[model samples]
Target: MESLHGKVVLITGASSGIGRAAAELLSSKGAKIIVNYLSNKKGAIETVQRIQKNGGDAIIIQADVTIKEQVNAMVEQALASFGKIDILINNAAGGIRQSTFMDASEELWEETYRLNINSVLLCSQAVLTHMIPRKEGKIINISSTAARIGGAGESIHYAASKGALNTMTIGMAKELIEYGIIVNGIAPGMVETPFHEKFAPNEDRLSRMSATIPIKRVAQPIEIAETIAFLASDASNYILGEIINVSGGR
Candidate 1:
């Protein structure tokens, strides 16, 4: 990947997991980071501190990405701090628990869509204001393999929401590429993140799922961050409207 030096990156839900990892890694590569979080203020601070300690520039912003006004405000703050945003990581998501379709509530569906797809729309639109005029930028959406497999027994709602995200990624990629903005997505398989602790808390379940994976193991957050870093850099300049699967070959 090309150098990210001087690039200003805004990463949503960056308090922990893949977002945090991406922030730290990209910052290490010389990108100034805006770590956006909803409820995890402490994690956000830690992410910033780690970057700062490593001689990287970073700031934290609190925002509910699902809300348009909040997203706009966050972008404004990022611009105020960094002047411009060169990359936008639409990573803030997760609003559903493990539940079968028969047990899925309407509220679950609504919440999932708002968190996954709506947030992406709001953040991308808000950031585009800065990126389009410059005729250059990167937008990397975080999706999941469940989008293709249809999380039948658990989290079907979340799966559907990510499915919408994948489609939006392609659509936006085609629309924005003409203007020099590259829009792409990453569909990650099971990773040992807080997400599993919240939804699939059963250790046995995780182990079973791990055994089923072709690589016989789940991924780490940094593994996903590496791909994000790739998509965010000039190395992926020719890669557009694509959803790269980093699923251990599952």
Candidate 2:
């Protein structure tokens, strides 16, 4: 494993699931972590505690990434604490539920776009200001398999949002490459996270969904974290503008 010693990583949606797992794994590799959460203050605090207990440095910051001001403030806080940000993990996202285009409300579509796509743009923009000056950075966006394969009977809006993120990642990578900023994305398939609890509340439906993966199992949060860690490390220095799929052979 490439050592991330002394590197500072800022992770959005760090309260739970993949984001939380990434924070813990990266911290273990000797990176100072900034846990950014919108409403899960308790979860963020717990993540920070766990990192500290493991002899890792970390801090929790609350910010709604969809808002530009909040994202800017959150990045400022991270820079103030660590002096510089070496990596940015855009993992914050809104939940998706089954809804046909005709059945989807305007409010739902707008909110989904705001949280999923807008947050990525705002957070990445905030990071670019500081990262460009340093001429080096790593940005990892947590997209979804829905963006690639499309989710059926569910929020097409959510999938659309993630699709936009993929485009943004590619565009930003091309634009920022000269500055030594690597931008990449991960499109995860049916992971076992609190996401199901919010989207598919029915226990039977969740079980059936898990059975669809070719690996015969849902991905663990740690699995995605490990991939993110690899991309953030020096080992992936040659990679740029790539979207890695972490689906268990879906």
Candidate 3:
């Protein structure tokens, strides 16, 4: 944990959920955080405020990760505040309303790919310019267990996007290792986050999902963030190109 001292981490969708948790945890571990948000300004600001109140450093920037221009600008803003980018966490992604692939619209497919997969590419490409020359950096992309379970009838498209991300992690890791950049991913199962509150609002939905897992529970955002802390540190330097499943053994 202390291995992150004085490092700079840029996390997308950092206004809430796992992204926000990673932001707070990394800051607490002595890394300066650049909180990236698309539309949740209030949540982003509060994340920064909480970090500062705890004697940690953080800055917030608003940008739609799906857009190349906006994604590039976000990286610029981070460099403006902190001269270098030490970590890049691709956590900005979402699924459309529940639907089978046959019922899914082309627009839904495009939107899902844009945010979940394209954003990862754009941000990683932009950050490499800074990371390559330094010969050291960590790029942790967030995947999902849906990639393995094929979305469990929720949305096949969401699964496809994460599957692509997991593949990208492996490809990027091989390409970037000579430069000292470690590329990896985390595929989380059901987690307690605003995402569930909005998408699975049933009083017993989490319980129902928990029943399927050996652990009998969904994850807390901070629990995922703890794994993120490990991947972001030198201690995990040896674990490259692998997506560590934080799915309670699902």
Candidate 4:
């Protein structure tokens, strides 16, 4: 990726799981990474250390994307350090806890929407202020297949949140393209990451999930990260406002 060399990519929730994978892979391809973490300071530090160890340029910043103030501060700091943000990856989201619709609490739904959808709104708005002026930027969001399936399980709120994100991606893509900002999303299938640990912790459950996929396996974090990389790069120039599914044929 000749174009990726020295590009500045800010990745939210970058301390672990898919976020960490994107940060590491983008940095490996010579992109300068702004690794943002909300609560996992240890994981954030490890991500930075790994990038530095591999001779990649990176810096770690902690900010809860769900909060407007924190999101503002994080984007400001990135610009202060890097002068500009070329890519924005909205990956800061969670299911919070798994529970049936009847079992889901009002508080759980609110928090899930805050973390999953609100963060995307807040982060993209903050980054767009600068991107619009430059007339060039890439915003890649992490969505889920559940958005289409409607999460028959306890992840109804989670799926709903991502569904909102997917719609926003399409709208933003069309709205931002005239300004040279490309907004797209990736809907990854089951992946081997801490996400599953939080969502489906049991080994047998994971096995059952994997067996159900057409690939007979879950995705590795890097597999999803690699897709994000393509979306951020020049290779994705014509792909606007589309949600590309990376679900291993699921």
Question: What is the C-alpha local distance difference test score of each model?
Answer: 0.92, 0.90, 0.92, 0.92
Per-residue alpha-carbon lDDT of candidate 4 for residues 129-193, written as tens digits (9 for 90 to 100): 99999999999999999999887368899999999999999999999999989999999999888
For model 1, residues 1-250, the per-residue Cα lDDT tens digits are: 4689999999999999999999999998889999999999999999999999999999999999988899999999999988999999999888467777888889888988999999999999999998999999999999999899986357889889989999999999999998899999999998888987787678988888888789999999999999999999888899999999999988
Residues 1-250, candidate 3, lDDT per residue (tens digit)?
3468989999999999999999999988999999999889999999999999999999999999888899889899899999999999999889866778788988988899988999999999999989999999999999999999998666799899999999999999999999999999999998989877776788776677779888888899999999999999988989999999999998
Which prediction has the highest TM-score against the true structure? 1
Error (Å) of candidate 3 at residue 40 is 0.7
Q: In lDDT terms, how accurate is model 4? A: 0.92
Off by over 4 Å in 3: none
Can you tell me which runs of candidate 1 are displaced by over 4 Å? none
**Per-residue lDDT of 75 in model 1:** 97
Candidate 1, pairs of clashing residues: none
Question: Is candidate 2 or 4 superior in lDDT?
Answer: 4
- lDDT at position 154, candidate 2: 71
Over 178-202, each residue of candidate 2 has an lDDT whose tens digit, in order, gives 9999999999988778885688778
Q: After superposition, how far is residue 114 of candidate 4 from its true place, in Å?
A: 0.6
TM-scores, one per candidate: 0.98, 0.97, 0.97, 0.97
